[model samples]
Target: MATFTPTKPRTIGHVDHGKTTLTAATTKVLAAEGNAKAIAFDEIDKAPEEKERGITISRSHVELPIVSGSGLYALQGTNEELGEKAILKLMDADPVRQLYRPFVMPIEDIFYIQGRGTVATGHVEQGTIKVGEEVEILGLTQGEPLKTTVTGVEMFKKLVDRGEAGCKVGLLLPGLKHGDVQRGMVIAKHGTLKTYKKFEAQIVYVLSKFYLRTADITEKVQLPDDVKMVMPGDNVTATFELTLPYPLDHGQIFSLREGDRTVAAGVVSKVLS
Candidate 1:
C-alpha cells in the first residue's frame, strides 16, 4: 500500500464555539465520498449534555478527508466547555501526532541521581528505548547534537530494559551533569533529529491575545496581516521564533499558551532551516 502522511486537526475556541458543527461538517463531507471512517460523524456529540445543550461538552475523534491531501486525516473535535488548563491536559493526553521514529523523547527535566550520574526525565515521544542504546541530545546548544548513551531506564521506580514512546520515565546518562542539559531538549536515536530556532506555521483561529511576538521583548509585533491586534477568531500564517531551540517536526500540531489559557494552536508547516 502507498504511504500517506497524516495530519490531525482540532477545533478550538470558547464555549459554544461551534467546534462540533465544524467537525460534523467535515465528517459529513468525507462520508459522502464513501469514507467509512467518517460514517460515525455524529458520534462526536454523543454526550448527553451536548445533545441537551446543543454544545460540545466532550472531545471526539474522526477520520475526515482533507480536500487538498485527498487522504483521510485524523481530526479531533475538542470539548468546548473545558477550561484553559483542562484543555491543555486534553491536548497533551491526546496529542495530534504519534511518534514513529526510532526513539524520540523530549526532555522535561534533568537531575543527577545520587549514584546514577546525569538523569533526564520525560515521556518517550516516539519509538522504543532500551538500555545501553546510544542516543543524541538535540537543542541543547547550537552546532551538532550532543552524543550520549542510555545507562539505565526506570518508570515509576521500576527497572525496565525497554520503553516505547509515551512511556514516562527517567533515563540515566553517564559523564553528564544536570547543568549540561535541561528542559526543552530532545533525546532521540543518534543522528535522527534536527533542531530549529525559527519555523513557519499555520495558525488556526481561536482565543489569542498575541500571534506575533518579538524575541526577549514584551512588545508584540504586527502580524503579516498588519492587524492592530489579533482577537478570538482569525486565521493567519505567521513566522515565529521559538524561545528556545526545539525539534518540532512539520505537520505536527502545537499550541500557543499563556498562564493557563492556550491562546492559539497551529501546525508546523515549514522548518525555516
Candidate 2:
C-alpha cells in the first residue's frame, strides 16, 4: 500500500480554456482509480452564471490525493505531471517554517504589585518571549521607547519562564511605577516595533458610521471629499491620520466601530511617517 498526501492543485490559464472541464475529468479519473470517492463536475461550478457561460469566474477548492509525505501540499501546474521528486522539492521549499516574527504584546491592562512593580498584561500578538529578556514600551510617550527587562512572567495565575504568540501573560517590569505604562502601549522586543501617526489601509464592509478604535482611544475617520459615506462591501484604500502616534506594523488588524458596536475591520497596508 502506498501512502498519499492531500493536495490542492490550482488550474490557471486564459478564460474558456477548459479549466473546469480538465478539473472535472481529473476527479473522475481519480474516482475510477479508487483514490477519490466521487467526481466533482457539478461541484466545480455551481453558480448560475458559470453554468450559463461554461467558465469559472470565481475561485474553487478541491482536494485530491497524491503520493507523498504526510503533510499537505499545494501543487501548482499540472497535477498529473508532478512526480515524487517534484513533490519532495515543494515540501522542502515550504515557506511556513522559514518565517521569523518578533514579539509584540499590546498592553490592554496594567497593574502594580506592591513588591514586584508594574505588570503589563496582554496577549502576545506574535513571536515568543522569555524571562530576563529586555523589551521596549512603545506608544506611550511621544517619540520615546521605554526599555525594561522582563523579570518574571505569569499566566493563568501560574508562574512561567517563557510565553509565545496568542498567550495572555502578565510581564513583571521592575523599576517602573503604575503611572509609567498605560493601556494601548505595546511591549515589544527592543527595536522591533515603531510608532506611526499616519498609515494606509484597505477598508472593507464599510458601515454607515464607523470610527477607528485602537489602544483604548477612538477617533473618527475623515473621508475624502468625493466620497460621501462608505457602504457595505466597499473595498477602498484610505489614509488614516491619528491625533497621537501608535505602535503599528504592516498587516496589523484594527476594528471599525460605530458607537458601542463593531461594524467593520481593516488591515494596515503601509505606514507613512
Candidate 3:
C-alpha cells in the first residue's frame, strides 16, 4: 500500500489577491495529475461572508498529499507578491526543534473497557511511546505525577505496538479507573513532564480582555504591566498565573480565549513556579 504524508501549503498574501481561488485551482491541478483529490471551489470558500465579499476572512486549512517518505512536511505557496524565492527560503530553513521533543499527550477523554481496563485517548503532541513502557500522568492530581504502564496502543481502532508524534491513539492503561483520570490530565514519558501554576509566556495578538482557558477551567488573567497596552499583531512577554496547575513544558503553545472566541496565542517561555 502506498503511504501519503500530509503537507500544509500556506496561502499568504494581501486582501483580494485570489489566495482562495489559487488554492482551489491548485487542488484541481493536483487532482488532474493524480497527486491529490480535487476539492470543490465552493468547499474551499464556504463561509457566507466569504461568498459575499469574495475573500476569505478567517484562516483556513486544506490538506494536500505529497508523495514523499514517511514523516510530516510543510509546503509554502504564496501569491506573486510574496514570490517563489521566499518559498524556497522557507523550505531551506531549519526544522522546528520542538518536533524532536519528549512525548506529551494531554488526555482528551477516558474510557473503561470491561476486560481491558482504562483507555486514555488523545493526540500525541510529540515524541514516541510503545507498549510496555512507563508513562507519567500529570495535572489531574496535584503533588506527584502518577505512573502507569502502557498495556496496548490502538489507533483508529487498530492495535498498534507504538504511538508517536501526530498520532491520535488510545493507550490501554491498567489499574486505573475512569474517575482517576480526566480530560485535563496529561501523559508523558516518566519524569519528563511537570505541573505548573505560574509561567512566563510570549503572547501574540492578544485582546485587552481575555481568559486563560485550560481543559478544566477558564480563569481571567491580566497581562503583565509592560504589555498591558499590547495591540493586535504585537508580540509581548507576559507572566500568567493559573488557578490550577497544568502539565506545561517550555515551547508548549496555548490559546487565550474570551468566552468562545480565541483572541490570542502564546507559547510557554519559562515555568515560574
Strongest candidate by TM-score: 3
Residue-wise C-alpha lDDT for candidate 3, range 12-32, written one tens digit per residue: 557966566556655554555
- Candidate 2 runs further than 4 Å off: 1-99, 205-214, 220-222
lDDT of each: 0.63, 0.68, 0.68
Better of 1 and 2 by TM-score: 2
Which of 1 and 3 is ahead in lDDT?
Answer: 3
Q: lDDT tens digits, residues 34-127, model 1?
A: 6524534457777788778866765533332332211122334333233222332332444444556679887877888776688888878779
Candidate 2 per-residue C-alpha lDDT over 117-198 given as tens digits, one digit per residue, 9 for 90 to 100 = 8998987877888889999998747768889899888775667777777667889999887588888888889988788888
Question: Candidate 1: which stretches are off by over 4 Å?
Answer: 1-100, 205-222, 225-228
Ranking by TM-score: 3, 2, 1
Lowest summed-lDDT stretch of 10 residues in model 2?
68-77
TM-score between model 2 and native: 0.59
Query: How many clashing pairs per prediction, in order?
Result: 1, 0, 0
lDDT of 2 at 82: 44
